[model samples]
Target: MVVLPATLVPRLDFIPSKPHQRDGYEPEFRRGILFEIDLRTFLATLITVGSYVRIMISNLGRIGWAVVFAVLIALTIPWFLWGDGRVAYGLPVWLWWHIGWMIVVSLVFTLFANRAWGTGIEEGA
Candidate 1:
């Protein structure tokens, strides 16, 4: 299961208009799972995002950049440190790993924002 950050409120589960290919072209679920979406909440979200402009960033032209981030994210799980009982500076090894990982993440974000922000879009258009 792909996981999104907890802070992000994803687009609601309500499919506004497009009927499903299954379920006899109906809007309801096929497995008898009932979902309730409020009209007020839906309308509020629509208005908020109605005027939104999206910038699509694909790593098709920058495979190396994508690989770098993928490696960084994979190592963030600290699978190797699961059985670690070591302590450094009064903190567990995993905690120290996360702190250092966060620093690297921050630096990568800084580099991306400063150097690669909005790259390729203008050229493509």
Candidate 2:
């Protein structure tokens, strides 16, 4: 039997580089849209532009869109809202939050589809 040298062995301590990162094993990240500051501001602008754009394409304006976006951002984050060690419907409070959030998202999506959906594409294009 032949013994392999250690140089041929793969290192177990290797750290993987994450996507959108600039360098390997470094905290530096690539310049991307998400890396830009003012995430909340950006989200607000996006929602506003999207709503107006939809209005231009369709007669109906986006309704309860800001509320939906606010709720989605608020509920998706697990920091501010704690579980409180409470359980409901055989599920934790935090889990219930997500479930309710999903239901709200589904309803909002349906509403957008029926009333506010727009691709910003021209009729001929």
Candidate 3:
């Protein structure tokens, strides 16, 4: 009692290739299901996403550095109040402090990835 969409149902003109020869090999016309996909495209998409996850998880040092930066920023309080309640460069000093922290985090992560992660490739190869 299997049901399939109209588009997925095998058409009358569609013929399955035979690998071996038979006495009277008239192509069997059966109402069977056929599924097709480009192997290269499927594998490429799978590999790309898998590689991204692998690289992100493999870089333990980079993750640790980012976590430390985040925790430090969250716990620090003096910088938030050190701005003398004034604005600088059209933004509050506290806001600038946060912006600077973000920049530092980006730089540290980039450096760690470049020097320690090593492009997510194996060491020997």
**C-alpha RMSD of each candidate structure in angstroms:** 17.1, 22.3, 11.9
* lDDT per model vs. reference: 0.64, 0.56, 0.59
> What order do candidates take by TM-score, descending?
1, 2, 3
The true-versus-predicted C-alpha distance at residue 47 of model 3, in Å, is: 38
What lDDT does candidate 3 reach at residue 99? 80
| Model 2 Cα lDDT, one tens digit per residue, 24-114 | 4455533222223354665677899998876664532323555566767776756655747888889888887788878878887897677
In model 1, the Cα lDDT at residue 88 comes to 94
- lDDT by residue (42-110, candidate 1, tens digit) is 567777665342322344435556777899989898999999999999999999999999999999889
**lDDT winner:** 1
lDDT of 1: 0.64
Please give me the total number of clashing residue pairs in predicted model 1.
0
TM-score of predicted structure 2: 0.40
Q: Give per-residue CA lDDT, model 3, range 1-125, as digits (tens).
A: 23333365445345443332368665553334343335566467789989887766667555775677678667445454674778898988877777877787688678766766543355521
TM-score of each predicted structure versus truth? 0.47, 0.40, 0.32
The alpha-carbon deviation from the true structure for residue 116 of candidate 1, after best TM-score superposition, in angstroms, is 0.7
What's the C-alpha lDDT at position 114 in model 2?
Answer: 75
Residue pairs clashing, model 1 = none
> Alpha carbon lDDT of residue 28, candidate 2?
50
